[model samples]
Target: MMRWLSFLQLCLSLLLILPLPLEAFEPLTMGAIGLGAVGFGTYFKEYTYCKFTECCDDRSIPANIEALRSSLNRYLFGQHIVAQHIIPALSAHFQSRSTSRKPLVISFHGQPGTGKNFVADQIAKALYLKGSESSFVSKYLGQADFPQAGMVDAYKARISREVRNKLHECPRSLFIFDEVDKMPSGVFDTLTSLVDYNAFADGTDNTKAVFIFLSNTAGTHIADHLGNLMKGGKLREDTRLSDYESLLKRAAYNLDGGMKKTTMIESHVIDHYIPFLPLEKSHVLSCLQEEFWRWDRNPDSQKNKKLIDDIIDTSISYDRTHGLFAISGCKTLEKKVAVAVNYS
Candidate 1:
């Protein structure tokens, strides 16, 4: 395995290596506007690249499929998607005959970049191919608490109804609740009935369904990143750069530009795969000064390199101490994940 720098190089190399097609190819899949439809499915070309082609399932998986990857998807920069370990606990709740129990119910909460969306996307694909599916989006309601007078119940019913419809449409789907922590306590209690045994109104087999609750930095898991902010602006703490901070700020700033916007460099480092802080303006200018020289291939560029070299020379060495944050000069390892992210 290459260091983080190599990943950057790999991303660049792959882009260079891709074969440019002579003619435009039609996109493999098409979609429309519905909670039911907004996914990239059945899109990749189903080409047979092996000799024993019949053995390989010609069915093309979505390019985004990543259940097997052990790490957070690079695409989910600075987010805490549920690790594979937590998934099994939810899976355990559904080990019975489908007819014997109600579907499983689960909830998740976490900081903004803590991988909730990424985890949901992975679960959806897996369920599409294997199990039942349903989804709840907190953004559907206008308010964080969803206090729109019956709108919460309506959305809940709509999601439950959709789940019923989806069960009929596809035999299995993994129900995902995005931004679950944002829902009001009342609404969450109503939905969480399925999690508590005998809490369902019908007293049916709802417990059989797969259940999950995703929380970033919840309790001890969140103590480091979220620290006091989990108390909702009441608790004060010295620790910063948290998902809670990012989420609350987004909520407070909406379209006002008051909150610091999320950046690509912060996103990649937030994943814990790398440790990088968002670059300040001066840091960015210095970086640009260094990058300005990479463009010139002529010997006259020696001065430009020397300037960058001097800067690197005087700067604090990025060694084990730098790993305290999620970034480094080692941009050669995963050329893919690296180039995909703009750390500079």
Candidate 2:
């Protein structure tokens, strides 16, 4: 009798401790999944549904417009990719890969309304045209979704495997993750693992995908902070402008003062001013935690002091209009399809 009870307990423990199998996070609600992509709730308002590129024919897009700018011309308005920051990444990705090596991993983050989506879309187009590609369909999983292993690692693994399969079928392709900041830390850590290596093994290749995280965590404040460190923040904008006008003379006079030196897009106008600084990850997460906790306290979003958990569980965000762009079901992957890249 004692042996039988011990055996039963051992089996039960093993069952409970087993690594989660993929497909458990498959999308059922919140929108399309498994080949069916869904619409992005318009940040400002509802617009016409975005038809998947599979539906688009070769004749629809111009052949000369093989690059990012032309590809995004139809969909983007004022929202555009910062070509200065992104073009080099693409060139590097394209130029590299002589043999087996780690892939490039780029993390883009900024404050809300800093045009995270626009940059992501440009990067998507760039990667998509390089050959063939796959994307993880986003779902709006809430805060409660964050703690579960079923929701995080396995779900992300499923997508990675899908991308890997596509790569074997089509060696040239890219994978992109939009609004990745919202996913739980478990998934983030797993994705980061692959990203750090920039490569995956052959067995897991079935769903391995190129990883890019588009985020709003990076902010403009870092530039100012760096600027202040170089020259006291006491100098007002107008004074700084005057100093720029006299830059050459200031350099000769020993007044270069360690102020930052930056280049402008057009020398003829010189209307644009640029600040230099990489948006550190720590600042972004700090702001994110604050927002996460703030949303946690809101009465409308809280599941309660007792019932479910995960700070992202109760977070709320509104677009240009007051309508709620709920983050309830944001993890989904569209089915993979075979297509040829004819950027011509």
- Candidate with the greatest TM-score versus the true structure: 2
Distance from true location, Cα of 80 in model 1, Å: 9.8
For residues 131-185, what per-residue lDDT tens digits would candidate 2 score against the true structure? Answer: 2233332222223334354565576676556555655654444454554434444
Q: Which stretches of candidate 1 lie over 4 Å from their true place?
A: 1-66, 69-81, 90-102, 130-150, 153-171, 195-208, 211-221, 225-344
The per-residue C-alpha lDDT of model 2 at residue 108 equals: 45
lDDT of 1 by residue, 3-90 (tens): 4465456447547634656243334421121211322111111222322221112132121233524333433333223343334533
Lowest lDDT sum, 10 consecutive residues, model 1, at 268-277
- What lDDT does model 1 reach? 0.35
Per-candidate alpha-carbon RMSD to the true structure: 18.9, 23.8
Cα-based TM-score, every candidate: 0.37, 0.38
